[model samples]
Target chain A: MIRPANIPRLLLTPAILTTVVTLGVCLVVLLVLSFGRQNYLDIELGLSAHNFELALTKPLILKLMGKSALIATGVTALSLILAYPIAYLIAFDIHKNKLLWLILFTLPCWISYLLRILSWKLILGYQGVVNSSLMGLGLVDQPIDALLYNSNSVVIALTHAWAPFAILPIYVSLEKIDRALMKASGDLGDPPYRTFLRVVLPLSLPGVSAAFVLIFIPTFGDYVTPHLLGGPTGFMVGNFIAMQFGASNNWPLGAAVALVSMLTATLLVCLFIAGSKRAVRAIG
Target chain B: MKNGLERWLVEELECGRIDRRRLLKMMGAAGVGMAATTWSASALAENNLTILSWSGYDIPEMAPAYFDAHPAPDFTLMGSDEEGFQKVHAGFRPDLGHHTSFIVGKYRDAGLLKPIDRSRLTHIDDFFPELEQIVTTDGKLWEAPLSWGNSSVIYRRDQVEVTDSSWGLLWDERYKGRIASRDSLEGLLIVGGLYTGAADPWEMTDAELEKAKDALIAQKPLLRFYWSSQTDLEQAFANGEIVAAYGWNASVAMLRKQGIDMALMKCKEGIVTWTDGLVMMSGGSASDDLAYEFINAYMSPEVGAFLINSYGYGSGNAKAYESVTDDRLAELGITDPDVVISTSKFQREISAETRQRYQAVFDEVKLS
Candidate 1:
């Protein structure tokens, strides 16, 4: 009665059930809560779109959402630009001790995320390493006040925090590419750059897209980085959502803002995937 | 009994006398037995008192007498009063909870709190009458006053020259990009109202709210960052990253300890004062006797002295001042509690609608 194929299905049953029970149930609860009304500290559950309407129409919320998306996109673009080179190096050039190279590259991930972010604060603070070094070298008479506590500082910290996550996927896809394709392109009289552009880069699009989505989604909802480094102007949608749940005591609005952010991020990610697919096809 | 059984199972597993699976099974059986015992002994609910408090307030020093009478109560730390209030409103059944006076009305209105009997508090006479008055409504006391403090502009005296000790020093152009404001709705809006000369900072009109919002937006550029924690503000001051900031009494005492020459300004407008205390939950599983014992222990002069001397906060117990030295009191800037209270404006309770408007203005300023 117990076949091997059925055994695999049975083995997968727990994971499937877990996903449904946890993620699926949570999403449904959040959806319901988003439409409810906030009565003092308690949420009066009912059918209403007032929260969503305010989330969408409020100038402050809309502006913060836009700013969060822009910051996330900038972080994604920067991570890709920075990660691709390192990933390419590890995939193609580091034939000796490739595992060692990989471990070295991801060594920062071993530290706590909070510690890593705090270290960036130390490196970028007014009396931080960068400013001290600059001032010591006579690069400037005053410490650069703009070095920390802004959107750029937030972008820098996030790009560092998610570097390993971005690098690994791109590296995996690059490693999976067949060397013969590059040889074929070169054999057909294509230059090295052409081979890289047409064959290698297009083929590695999956990893690149994976890396993009991985960083973009979390970065969009990042509260700590922006809260710590993103001075006054760097407050994001996540902070706004947190304020609603905390000081504002408006769970319905917080839920609605959160759902709206998720939907907007999903739409952008879809558009990105579609655009990347087009680029891949055109290049190939 | 549970601990003994668990230790025995661990030892047996380590000596290879029992497999891990068998040890786990035995442990599970022991846990079930423990649960059964707890359920059967539910009449002795005082033994199961649960306390929800701010992080450091749950230490044994805060309630020595209670500890002597019973085992350590279950302690759950909350980061803020808002967080604690939300947890209780969402059906958390802790016997005792900590909250600020400003939010006590909200808790009372929500029917989450029980009226505290004054006759039950042994240390009631030691408490400042002014503070007790703040937490009382309709001749019923709702919370036992614990710690009180002032929120004011703290500045590095050597680094910045101030002609006037006013809240305007926070928005001074001379300290451009070298100042920090509090990242709090109540703190920020109150600062805005006071600076803009609103009649009542806590109950500003629509136009007053707008004026405060505009004033905050203009001051945003001059801020290095809005500090949410006392530690961050202290670190910034220590590093010379900021010369002025809106801070609490703890920061003033802390920075002075580090030899930062920090001064807590006696602002011309008024300093913001706040008090936080312990309240009994209405439907808590624990017995009222246990809750009263814990509140009394926390309010004792010894515990009050510990709070003031250790944390640089004003203890609600007036007699606690006798234990603290006059010099230490001066260093903490609470030389006379009556004078401080008279000169300072209390952060009072506001309606939900007013709170929303204030929050909106604060959020709008931050986002802008």
Candidate 2:
């Protein structure tokens, strides 16, 4: 810092400028709408928290917000759980063909995500292939209605959607670990499990945190999954906000809802960073 | 085990964010919803008229023949009625909008429309008198009638036994969880009102609506799915997810055209009828002459018949069937327009309190 140069600032200027422009546009628009009086059918400007009040008060709105949070959280946790083992195996166990396997694991990322979700519906609907196969095999005489348009289906679809996102980060973190540390832990009379707990797990926290933040943020505001497979009963807050702006014409309320979710996510990310810092300090 | 992993690998191979949207719908409704918000003033000297409508409803094939003869007018497509309402309030200007009759009163009250000039509309009398009366307030016509269809039983005659014309099959235990319905609060609420024998679905008493809601809730267990699109509903029928689902007159012919064997039963609980009417916006009244001209020309028997063949709904012009062959009329089940109207009530506008109550019931019904 004492020798800070003009070149470094210039090098960073483009990235900082891009982020500022992107966030500035969004921030100004959302801030403007959040404080206005934009109702479903009419726009009468007033200085009131009517939009925020509606966000806080409406049972339907709050319920959808809660559902969005829960779905996002569940998707993140499940993705981490499912991806960790594969990521670990790819990074540590399959050193001979690691790149080939990694490439293979990421192939689904190339296809459209919406197409994959639609495929699940094709397999889960009443006359879907899975239902017919189940009936044909006499597993049960009836198609399982629960297999479609519920929290369970959303979780399955979202977890599948977010699996790759979780895997790559954990793999990167795991790959970056020092081999000497693992050998040292093993030489200290620790078992493989202890070595993993003492060496690998703590180092992977950064990647896990990154995965959680990345998956949680997008899933928190996902609009299509619930619409396509979630059905009318599968209402989510994102869907409500979408309707508010789209069909209901309530811009202020939608903006208010969006702002609240963003604030919540910001608090969580900060808390995660702070806690991770404290944990490192305590370990030292 | 490898097969399961391979499928999962194939299914979810991407270790990255993958989100592909099916519908190219814009993210927010703020712009689209406000698309109909009336303008503060009209630059009146202009002769052009802007019509707000469903995309398919504005198809030149279904539009007035003279529209092609004259310079084509401007159009804005709305996603739904709610969106149309929002767009108008947000100052998205349109010269005309074809909304259900229920909204005419609110539109007029909100000063969003101009009274129809019947003298300028040559084929105004061609519309069923019932529609004229239904869309009127205090002996003044607000919007000109366009077309009408009933929310009746559309089922596969080949699959389900058609024992009754009532809405009973919507909750038949034999077909539990294999039925489908439209995903509208009004469609379900009004249909429930009729199912419980309410005198008028549009004006059902609160207690009666609660009962109607319970009936809908009972049907939830019987529903295969609730559809918001032709693609979903069409797929449901093709895949046999639904046996006797709520369908449009359009769907009946479309399904038949796709070679999907199905039938539209004249459900005995009569039919829950809805109508669309063209209203002149307040700001666009300067172009009212063009609007009225289009309206009249759009209601010609040939235009009306073309609409029937195109959209599966009958046009308001009573003589429209005369321009069509018996096979075409038979294909549409339009031997008599008056008879169909008699079996229906024009969905009337309700107070917001009443709409919210019905919506609440609709939510309960879905979760139930």
**lDDT tens digits, residues B284-352, model 2?**
533666777778777677778877887678788898878777887777677888887765666767766
- The TM-score of chain B in candidate 1 is 0.84
The CAPRI classification for model 2 reads as acceptable
What level of docking quality does candidate 1 show? Answer: medium
lDDT (10s digit) by residue, model 2, range A159-216:
8888888888999999999999999998988899877776888888888888888898
Q: Which one wins on DockQ?
A: 1
Where is model 1 chain A poorest over a 10-residue stretch in terms of lDDT?
A: A242-251
Per-candidate Cα lDDT values, in order, are 0.84, 0.74
User: How does residue A282 of candidate 1 score in lDDT?
Assistant: 85
Report the TM-score measured on chain A for model 2: 0.88
What candidate 1 keeps of the native contacts, as a fraction, is 0.66
